[model samples]
Target: MNQGQAAAVFEGVYARRLDMIHRFPPGLRALGTRYIEPLFVAIGPYHRHLPRVQEMERMKRVAVHQFMQDTGLDWDALLAAAGVVAAQARALYDIPPAQNQGGDDPAAVQVPEAADQGEPQPHEQGAGQQEQNQDGVGPAAEQALGAGVQEVLAAGHHGIPLPPLPMSNAGFQEMLCIDAFFLLHYISMRDADNVPPSALAHLFYSRRSLIDNDIMLLENQIPFFVLTHLNELHPIFLRPFVAKLATNFHGHKSTRRIPPFQHHGYTPPHLLALLRFCMKEPVPAPPAPDAAGGPQQAPDAGGGPQQAPDVEDGAQAPAPDAGGGAPPALDAAGGPQQAPDVSITFTAIGLEEIGINLNVSDRNRFTDMAIRKRSFGPHLFKDPLLLGRELVLPQLFLGNVSSNYLVNMAAWEVCTAESYVERDTIVCSYIRILAMLMHREDDVHQLRAVHLMEGELTDRETLDLITSLGKHLPMGERYVRMLASIEEYKLVTWFWIAVHKLFYLYFKKIATFFAAIGSLAGVFKAFELVLVKKHQ
Candidate 1:
C-alpha cells in the first residue's frame, strides 16, 4: 500500500472508539493469565483461534441449532440482520483481522466431523482422529464419539452461516449473531423448567461455573449493540426476556437498589460494561467553596458548635497550628493546604480503641460511608462532648473471583477511559483505602470481626488480594487529602485518650495518699484522748 493509503487506514482505525474490550496489560498478565483468559470457551474474536478453547466450538454449534429451532427464527434472517451491523461490531473489538483465520495455524486443532453415520469424512484429520486411529478403538467407541461430533458439525452448517470455527468475513458475521443468540437463549432459559435438551444444555449444566467465569472475562464479549439488534428482530415477547436475563446475570443486587440506568443516561456497551456500571456509584459533584474560597465548615457531631469548615472528604485539611493561632491560611490558589504531618501513624484498630464503632452498613456500594456522632454526653466545663463517633462502612464482599473481576474493571477504566479516573475516583480511592487499612493480617481480622468483610479467604490472602489489585493505581489528589485527614484525626484521638488515662492515674494516686494521711491523724487524736483520761 502507498503512504496515502496507509495513513488513511491508520486514521480510520484511530478515529473510532475500539477500546470497549482490552487484553490485560503486561504487568497484570504477568501475575497470571488464568484469570484474564477464558478457560472453557471463546466467545469473541480475540480468543476464537486458541487451541485450548477450540473444543467449545462444537458446543456453540449445538446451542445455535437448539436456539433457532426453539425460537422458530429463520437462519438466513439472523445472518442478514447480523450482516447489517457486522462492521460496527467488528470495530468494537481490538483483535486483528488476520487472527480470525483459524485453519491455517498448526497449533489450532479443529474437531473432526464425519459426513455419514458409518464413514468418516475423507478430508477430516486432526487430534481426535489421530488418537482414535492410534488407539485402534472398537466400532462402538468410534460410533458414539463420531456420531456426536457429526451431529454438532451438522448443526453448525445448517443453523448458522458462521459457526464458532473460524472462516471468512461472512462467516465472522454469522459467528457474532449465533454466539450472541446462544448467550441470550441460555441466560433467558437458564431458570425455565421446560427447556429442550441439547449439547449446550448438558455443557452449561455440567460446567456452569466454568462457563460463567469465561463469559465474564473482559476479552470474551460481543458488542451489546449486536445483541440488541438481534433481540429487536426477534419476537416482541423475547426482547424483555433477554434484557432481564442480561440484567440479572451482570447486575449486582447491591447496585440494583439504585438503578444506574436512571443516572448514567446511556446504555452499557456490553455485558462486562453492564456489570461495571452496576458497581459504579454516582460521582458526587465537588463541594462548593465558601465566600473566602475555602470549603465551608460542617457542624461538629455534637451539633453545639461548627468545627473549622470541615474540609471536603477527599480534600486535604490545613494542619492545626501548634500555637493555636488563626487557622492555617488557605492556599492562595485554593489548592490543598500544606500540612505539617502527612504520615499515617495508625490503622482501623487504633480508631476502634477510641470508642469509634466500625460497623458495616448494608450499603456495600464502596463510595457510601459517613462519619457521625451517635450521641452526646455532658461535660464539667465545656459543651456536651460528642461521645460516640461511628465510622459506617459499606459491607465489602471478597471472594475467590473478587480480585480478578475488580482489577480488570479498574484496569479498563484506567486504560480506556482516562477521563473517568479524574471524575470517578471511587474505585481507585476505595482500593487505596483498603490497602492502607489492611497493612497486616490483624487488620483483615479486625474488619472481619466487625462484619465488614464476608469471605472464606485467610487474613493473609485478603491482604494479598487487595495489595495486588491496588498496585500501580493512581492516588488522586482528593484521595491523598482524605487519607491525610483520617491520619490526622487518628493522631488527635490517640492523644486525647492518652491524656485522659494519664490524668485519671494521677488523681487516683493523690486520693489514696490523702486517705492514708487522714487515717493517721485520727489514730493520733484517739491516743491523745486516752492519755488525758489516765491523768484525770
Candidate 2:
C-alpha cells in the first residue's frame, strides 16, 4: 500500500483495536489510553520509516506543543515521561522477531506442549550446558524471550493476539504531538513579560492545521483533536507546557517600546479609560439624522457651534452638554484644535455572541491563572479585574490615544507619556510604564511630576481612573502603589483630615437646625389646637 493507504488502513485497524481494548475494566478507566496506545503504535513505525510521515510527525509534534501551551497543558514533562517509557521498552526489545515474520504465515506458533523426552532432565542439564557453549543467548535473544513472555501475558489478559500496530487515531495523536512542540517552541522563545510578536503570529498561523487535520472534530467547532482530550491525558506532563506559555507571556514588556498615549502623557487616567472604552469595539454611528435633522451642536472651543457628524444608529443620541461649553483646555493661540472632543461608542454584542461572559469569574480566571502560574504575571496578561475580561488591545489604545491627544501634549513635555515615547514607541502602553520603572533615568522625579498632575483628581474619580487604566498599562501594580503613597503623604493626609472635620461641622449644624425646626413646629401645632378648642 502507498503511505496514505497504509496510514488509512492502520488507522482503521488501530481504532478497532482501541475500541476492543477499551472494553477492559482497567484500561477503560485510564482515559484516552486505549486510543493513545493504538494511535502511537500505528504511527510509530511509519514515523520511523516514511520520510513524509516523519516530517509530518515532527511538525505535528511541534504543533502539539503549541496547542498544549495555548490550552495550558504540561506537554513537555508528559512527553519526557513517554520518552523514558519508550526508551526502556526499546532496550528490552531490539526488534520483534514476529515482526520479521512480515505479515506472512501466522507468526511462528510456539504452542507450549508436553515434550516426549521430558523425563530425562538430569543429564539434559549437562547436555544443555554444552549446548549453551555452542550458542550463547545474548541481550538480543533475551529481549526476544522477554517479548515472547509479554505477548503471552498480553494474550492471557486481553484474550487476543497483539495485532500489528494500526493507524486508527494517528491524525488526532499527531495533532496533539504537534501541539506539544508548538507550545514548547513558544515557551522557549519567550523573553520576560512579552511574547515575541513573531511567535504569536507563527502560532496563530500554525493553528489552522488543527482544523485542516480534522482528526477529532468537536461540536463547538473549536478543533479538539489534541486539546479535546486534555483531561484524558496526564495533566502532570501537560502542566509544564501550560506553565511555560504563562511565564513567557507575562504582562510587562521588558524589551518592547510602550505605545504613544501613556508614553506621551496626553491623556490622563480618566480620559485614557474613556478612550479605551471607545477603541474596544467599533460602534456603528447613530442613524442618519431624521428628516428634521441631527440634534443641535454645542458651540465649539472657538465660540461657534460646529456641525455634528451624521450618525447612523437611530437608537443612540449623543448626550447633550448642559451648556454650550468650551472644551477642557486651550492652546497658546487659544485655538479650538488644542481641546480633544471625547466621544464614546459602545456596540453591544451579547455575552453568548462572543462565547465568553464578561461577568463570569472562573472561566475567565482559569485562562489567566494558568498563564500566570507559568510566571508571566498579571503584566503578561492584562487583568484589570481579578477575573479578567475586556482584553487590552494595545494597538487600539495606542491609535486612539494618538489621534485624541498628540497635539495637546507635545513630545517635549516632561510628562509620563512623553518619557514612554522616548523609549520604545511601538510597545503597549502598560509595557512602557514597566520599562520606564525598570530602566529609565530620573524615574522618581518623572513619576513625581505625574503624581503632581494627579493631585487635581478627586479620590473616588482618581481611584476609578487608575484602576481602569491598569487594564492596559503594564505598570498597573506600580500605579496602584503610587496612588497609595499619594494617599499616605502628609499633604494629602492633612487635606483629607481637614475635609473630614469640615464635613463633621457641617453635619452638626444641619442637625441643630433640624432640631430647632421640630421644636417650633410642635409649639405651633399646640397653639393652633388650643385656639380651635376655645372657638368650639
Candidate 3:
C-alpha cells in the first residue's frame, strides 16, 4: 500500500457510478423492513443466504432447466457471455457497512431481520474481494450506513484494498445465470392462460402476491446490465418483461411483441427502476403567462372528462420557479440529504370548498399533475367554468399489493438522488401531494369518489400509509412547485374564495334551520296521536 496506489483507489471509487441497488437507509427501516425486504425470494447476492428465501434457491435451478428446454438456447454459450458480464458487474453492488469491520463493535447499525437471521448483515470484509482488487475496474468505494469508504478516500491514505465481495466471481456468475433464467421463465409463464408447466404453476400461482411484492424491493435487485447483456446474446425478452412490471403486473402472455418502453431509450438500473421509468412521463413545461398577466387559462382542445396535456413521453422539462420561499432539494448518496417539510395547505374537501376540483389523468403516471385556471371555454369536465380552477392528477391504486412497492419507490428516490439529477422525485412527491390534499377518512372518501384512488385498502389505512410515508420522504421538486402554485393560487383568488365561503356558510345555516323545524313538527304530530288514543 503506497501513496500512488491509494490515489488510484480514490479515483476509481470517486469516478464510478453509484450502486445499482442499496440497503434501504436506516432512517427508513422504522417504516418496517417488510416495506423494503423481499418476502418471497432473493434475486441477487445480498439476500441469497437468508433461510426464508433458501427454498426458492432450488427453484432457480429448476428455472435454468426449464429455460434451456423451452428456449432451445445452448447452455455453454449463454454461460460464457453471462460470466463475462458478471466480472464487469461485481463492482456494482454496494459494500456492506460492516464489510471491513466485524460487527463485534456493538455500535454498527444492523439490518433488523438480516442480523437476527445470522445472514451477513454488512459486517467484516471477506478476504476474497481484497485479492481480486487490482488497479483498473476494481470494486467501488461505497457508503455503508455509518462507515463510508468515501470518507477514507476523502482523507487520503495508503492504498488499502476493499473488503471481499459477498461471493467469488465464479459463484457470482453462476448466480446471475440462474437468476436471469429464473426471471425469464417466470415472466414467460407467470400469466399464461394455461396453467404454468410443472413447479412454476405452484410457485407463481399460490404465492403470486408475495412474489410480486418481492420483485419490487430495492435491496432485492440484480443489475439491469446482466439482463441487457443476456438480451444481446439472442434471447431478447427484457422488453415486454419490463413493460409488464411497469404496467403494474399486467398479463405478459406474449413477450415476442409489445414495444411500450423499448423505443424510449431508457436504461433502468434494475427492475424496480424500470417500473418507475414506465410510470413516469417527463414533467411538462409551464403554461406561458398571458397579456392579462396570469398563467394563461387555455381552453381544453382535447375534449375529455380528464386530460393531462399530451407531451412526448421522453420530453424533459425543468422545474418551474416556485415563486415563494426556498423549496427543499434531495442530494446524491451519502451525507445529510433531507429537505424541510412542505405541507399541502389544502385538503381534498378544502379544495372543493374553494371551488378547486380534483380530476384524474387518462394516463396513469406518477408525474402527472396540472393546475388549470377556470375560463369560459370547452372543457374535460364537460362544462366550461367562468370561475375556479381544475387540478388534474393521475389515478393511484393503494392496497396491500401496491403499498410496499410504492413506499420503496419513494425510498429509492431518496437513496439514489444524485446532484445532477432531474427535478422529479416522483413517487415521494406524489405521495406527499396526496398527503397534502388528504386530512382524514372523509378526504380519502373524496378521493375515491372522484376516482383519484381505488384499492382494497380502507380509508383509514390509505390515509395512514400516505401521510406516514410522506413524513419520511425528502420533499421533491414537483411536490414543492405544486404546493407553491396552489399557495399562490389561494393568494390571488382570495376574493372569490371568501365570497364562496360566505355564501356556503349562509346556505348551510338555512338548511339547518329548516331541518330543526321539521323535527319540531314531527314531535307535535306524535303528541296529538297519543292524546287521541287516550280519549278513545
TM-score of each: 0.63, 0.18, 0.67
Candidate 3 matches the true fold with a TM-score of: 0.67
Q: Lowest summed-lDDT stretch of 10 residues in model 1? A: 255-264
Taking the tens digit of each residue's C-alpha lDDT, what string does model 1 give over 220-312? 788776776776644222222222323322224422211112122334456665555445433333345557432343322211113244323
lDDT by residue for model 2 (1-536), tens: 89999999766644432111112123222222221122111122211222123334334444344444445555444444333333222221113333333331121111111223321111122223221111122233225344553454355346452322222122223322334334334333332333455544464345423322221111001111222233234221222222222211222223331111111111111121212222211323333333434213332221112434443212233222111122223346532222122211111122112111112112111111101111234423332222212221121112211311211111101112222221212123333222223222233223333331123333443333333332334322222222222222324335434544454447678778899999999999999999999999
Tell me which residue pairs clash in candidate 3: 98-122, 98-123, 98-124, 99-124, 99-125, 129-164
What TM-score does prediction 2 earn?
0.18
Model 1 stretches astray by more than 4 angstroms: 1-19, 99-168, 192-199, 235-264, 281-341, 344-346, 353-357, 371-384, 387-389, 419-423, 476-478, 487-536
User: What is the C-alpha local distance difference test score of each model?
Assistant: 0.54, 0.28, 0.60
C-alpha RMSD (angstroms) for model 1:
13.7
Off by over 4 Å in 2: 1-515, 524-536
Q: Name the regions of candidate 3 deviating beyond 4 angstroms.
A: 1-19, 73-75, 95-165, 191-196, 249-259, 282-315, 319-343, 375-385, 419-423, 510-536
